[model samples]
Target: MPLTKEDVAGIADYARIALTPEELDEMTAYMNDAIDLLEPIRQYDLEGVEPTFHPIGDLSNVMAGDVPDTSVRALPLDAALRNAGSSRDRCFRVPSILGDQGGDR
Candidate 1:
């Protein structure tokens, strides 16, 4: 089924997004188009195909492992916070980027 403007608007509202009427219409059309594109795949017959986790089968540690360097030691919390301009309860207290009204600062 094609997505309606109300459906798109509801999805936007659920995600805390503020979209104008024009944007809602555009997004609804776009989402429907994407769904239509994937509709052709439903006709394929794959009754016994096993579900795959990765597209390129059995990839083992493709990226470098996290091995800590022994030469450099981690700084203590006090030492780390020594140069900070403001701190509270063992944490850095930076100025709020979000305003009191929940808008941008």
Candidate 2:
């Protein structure tokens, strides 16, 4: 269904969006136009056509041999920790939110 200005305003209020009057009207028109455009698709005769699960051309799993390739570079611990907000012993540290870490449980 096409949305009304009141409907858009209600949604904006629910989402805590501060929309200007002009923006509200624009968004309402866009929402209504989207709904109106979709209406024609429902009238199509798609009775017997099997619903396609994936729209892209046929997909198949490309499998490879499980042999390990070891060209990946590992950064030094100190270099990796340079950009962290907090670190200890060359490791990035973060607040322990889980209670077990603080023995609070």
Candidate 3:
């Protein structure tokens, strides 16, 4: 079923958002607009047509022959290191972005 203004407000609440009344009205309109835009798809004659995730026809393996190729130098070491936000001696340094904290769920 299509969503309502109350539905949007509930979602925002779940996300812990502090939305103003104007924002709620805007979100409701946007949601309704999106639902209205998809109305034509419901009217489409898709009978006897196989639903495909990809728009293109069935793909066959088109891989090239496995051959040893010479490695091309992409960039100089100094430039590559400089491009990184932080780096150590010849290695790029990065903060721990992922992985669970030291505890079992």
Candidate 4:
């Protein structure tokens, strides 16, 4: 069934969105057009076809597995903190973006 303006308005209401009359009408047309485009797929005959979760089927990791290199050593804590503008308790300190609720981190 085609989407009506009222249906779109209801959806907008459910989503806590306030749409103008013109926007509601446009959204209704857009939703109906999308549904119409997919309507042709309903005519396909796939009685024995299994539903696929992944389009490419079962795929293993395509990237190379992680292999630790003993040649490369981790940077010392003192060296790592040397260039830091601010640090506290062996960790780099950054200004909290979540306001005073996050406290002084």
Report the number of the highest-lDDT candidate: 4
Output the lDDT of residue 103, model 4: 67
- Pairs with backbone N, CA or C atoms under 3 Å apart (clashes), candidate 3: none
Candidate with top TM-score is 4
- Candidate 4 colliding pairs: none
Across 61-94, the per-residue lDDT of candidate 1 in tens digits comes to 7877699766899788899899999887789877
Question: In terms of TM-score, which candidate is stronger, 3 or 4?
Answer: 4
Which stretch of 10 consecutive residues in model 1 shows the poorest summed lDDT?
96-105
Error of 2 at 40 (Å): 1.9
Indicate whether candidate 1 or candidate 3 has the larger TM-score: 1
What are the TM-scores, per candidate, against the unseen true structure? 0.49, 0.41, 0.46, 0.52
Task: Give the per-residue lDDT digits (tens) of candidate 3, residues 57-91.
Answer: 68666688787455865577898887789887888
Error of 1 at 11 (Å): 2.2
Candidate order, lDDT descending? 4, 1, 2, 3
Candidate 2: list runs displaced more than 4 Å: 45-105
Candidate 4, poorest ten consecutive residues by summed lDDT: 96-105
Task: For residues 1-105, write the lDDT of model 4, one tens digit per residue.
Answer: 897788999999999999999999889999999999998899999899999898788886678759866689978899999999899889998877777775667
TM-score of 2: 0.41
Task: Provide backbone clash counts, one per model.
Answer: 0, 0, 0, 0
lDDT of 4 at 45: 98
Q: Report the error of model 4 at residue 58, Å.
A: 3.4
